[model samples]
Target: MNRLFDKSIVLACCIAAAVGLAVDARLVAAFCLGVIATSLAEVAQGNRARRASETASYVYIIAAVFVPPFVPLAPLAFYDIARRVRREHAWVALGIGSVFAFALIADLRTDALTARTLLLTAILSVAATLLSLRTAQLEREQQRMRRTRDELQERALALEARNRDLADRQDYEVELATLAERARIAREIHDNVGHQLTRASLQTEALRVVHANEPRIAADFADVKRTVDEALQLVRASVHALNDNAVDLSVQLDCIVEGARSDGGPQVELEALAEHAPANVANCFAAVLREALSNAMRHAHAKTITVRCMEHPSFYQLIVTDDGADATPASSSNVAEGMGLASMRERVEALGGTFTAGPRVGAGGWRVFATVPKPQGDEDR
Candidate 1:
C-alpha cells in the first residue's frame, strides 16, 4: 500500500509541472508558495507552538487557493524554506497541497489541457500523502509498545534474581539451625549418659570383686552391663552432634557398628585400651578399628568380630580379626571390592600410616590391621 501511494505522489508532481508550464507562470508560482507556507506552519506545530502555527496554517492555505496557476515548482521552494526552519510536515504537505492548488486554478480556464492534467494529479497526491501520514503514526505507536515490552522483561529478570537470593538465604539458615541442634544433643548425651555409664561400670566391677566366687553375683554385673548398654545407645543417637568437625574415635567406632547392624550382620566387639595411649593415637586407632570391624561384619560373615586398639610410643595399631564361621555372601576374591576396606586404607595412609586386610592365617577368618603414624606433638601427651 505504501509503495502504491508513493508512486501516485510522483505522478501528481509530474502533472503539476506540466500544468505550470502551460498556464500563467506568475499566478501558479504565487499559489505554490502559499501552499508551501501553509504546510510549513502545520508541520512546525507537530511538537512546537500548536495554536499560533495552526492559525497561520489556515491563512497560508487560503492564499494558496486564491492564487493563479503556472507556479509549478514554487511550492517546493517554500517547502525547502520550512525545512530550514525545522518544521515537521512542511515539506511533505507542500509536495501535495501545492499541486492541488495549481490543479484547482487550472480548472478555471476551460481552454487549457494543462489544467485537466494538474487537477487529476492533485487528487492522487492528496490521497497518497494522507496514507503516508497514517502509516507513520502506526509505526510510532508500535515502537512505543516494543519499548514497554523490553522494560517489563528486564523487571521480570530482576524479580527472579531476588527470589533466588532469598531461597539461598533460607537454605543456609536451615543448615545452620540443624548443625546447632546436633551440637546441643551431643553435649546432653556426653554430660548426662556418659557420666552415668562410667559410674555404673565402676559399681559392676566392684560387685564382681565382692562376689568373686558366688555364681548368683553375676546378676549384679548384668545390671551394670544394662546400664552401659543404655549409655552407648544414647551416645549413638547424638553422635553427629559430638563430631566437632574433627576425629572422634569413640563415635566413629559406634557408627561403624550401627552400619553393620543395619545390614543384618553379626555382632562386633570393640576393645579400646587407651590407658597407655596418647590422645591422637586413641582417636586414629578408634577410626581404624571401626573400619576393620565394619569390613568383617559386612563381607566376612564372621560370628565373632574383635577390634583391638593398642598404642605404642611412635604409633598406634588397630587389629581387627573375626572368626569366619559363616562364609561371605560374595565369593569373589576382589580384595578391593565392596568391602569398605579400601576407603579405610586411604584414610589411614593419608595420615602417614599403613593398612592391611585379608584372610586370617590360622583358620577360617578375616582380619584387618592398621598402623597410624603419630603426630610429633602427640608423642609427649
Candidate 2:
C-alpha cells in the first residue's frame, strides 16, 4: 500500500513539473529540483534526515510563490509533513501551505486570478490535510491491534504452563493417596488378621499337646498346627507386600545389613538360624534386628556387627552385637535408656520375653539380645 502511494506521488509530481515546464522552463526546473530533493529526504536514514526532509517541504512553498501553476504541488509537501512530522509540526506545515496558496494567488496574472483557480487550490489543500490525518489514525489503530494480539498470545502460553503444573501436582497427589491407602490396609492386616493367625497357631499347638497320648489324633493335630504356621507366614508376607516392605525376614535383615555396609558403617555378619520359627517370633526378631543395626551404625559407630537367630528347645532368640566404643559394658543403673531401646524392651516383654541391650561384658561393642518363649511343650522338630 505504501509503495503504491509513493509511486503515485512521484508520478503526480512528474506530471505537475511537466505542465509547469510547458508554461515556463526556468520555473519548472526549480520546481522539479525541489521535488527530487524532498523525495530523497523522505527516504534518508535517521532523525536528522527526517527533520531535514520536513524542512525541504518549504522549497515547494517557495516555488509556488513564483509560479501560480506550482500552487497545486504545495499540497503534496503539506501531506508529507502531516504524515511524517508531529501534529504540531503538521499544523505549522498546513499554515505554511495555506500562506503559499495565497502567495500563488497574489503572484497570478490578472486573467489567472479567477474564482475557479482559487476554489480548486483551497479544495486540494483541505483534502491533503484530511487524508494525512486519516492515514495517521489508521497506523495508530494497526499498532494497537498488533499489541493486543501479542498480549493474548503471551497469556495463552502462561495458561498452558500453569495447566501443565496443575496436572503434575494432581498426579503426585493421587500417588500419595494410593500409598497411604496401601499402608492403612497393611496396618489392618497386621493388627487383626495377624493376631488371629497367631492365636490359632497357639491353640493348635495346645491341642496337639493335650492329645499326645492318642497317636493318630496327635499327628493330625500336629499337621493342623503346621498348616496354621504356614498361614501365619503367608499373612506376614501379605502384610509386608502391602506395606512395601521386604517379604521375608531374612531378606529384610540382609538389606539392612547391606545398607549399613554401603554407608561405610559396620561389616555385618548375619545368620538366620530359626527357619521354621512362628510368624510372631520372626516379626519381632525382624523389628529388633533393624533397631539394633540402626543403633550400631548411628550411636555405636561400630566396625563390626554380628546378627544371629537361635532356636532353642522351647524358645526363639535373636542376638545382635556391634564392636564399638559405646558398647563397653555398663551397669544397668548407669545405662541411659533411649526410645529405641525402650521400644524394643516393650515389644519383647509384651510376648513373655526377656529383652536386654547394653555393652557386652568382654567385647568392645554393644549387644542386643531378645529371647521369646514358645508355647509350652511345642518345638520346631
Top candidate (lDDT) = 2
Tens digits of lDDT, candidate 2, 175-223: 5577679889999999999999899999988998999999999999899
**Candidate 2 lDDT:** 0.69
| Position 303, candidate 2: lDDT | 85
Candidate 2: stretches off by over 4 Å: 6-46, 66-72, 88-91, 109-122, 205-218, 245-381
lDDT of each: 0.56, 0.69
User: What's the number of clashes in each of the models?
Assistant: 6, 1
Residue lDDT tens for model 1, 40-121: 5435635555545544544444444554343333333333233233257566556545655664655557444355545544
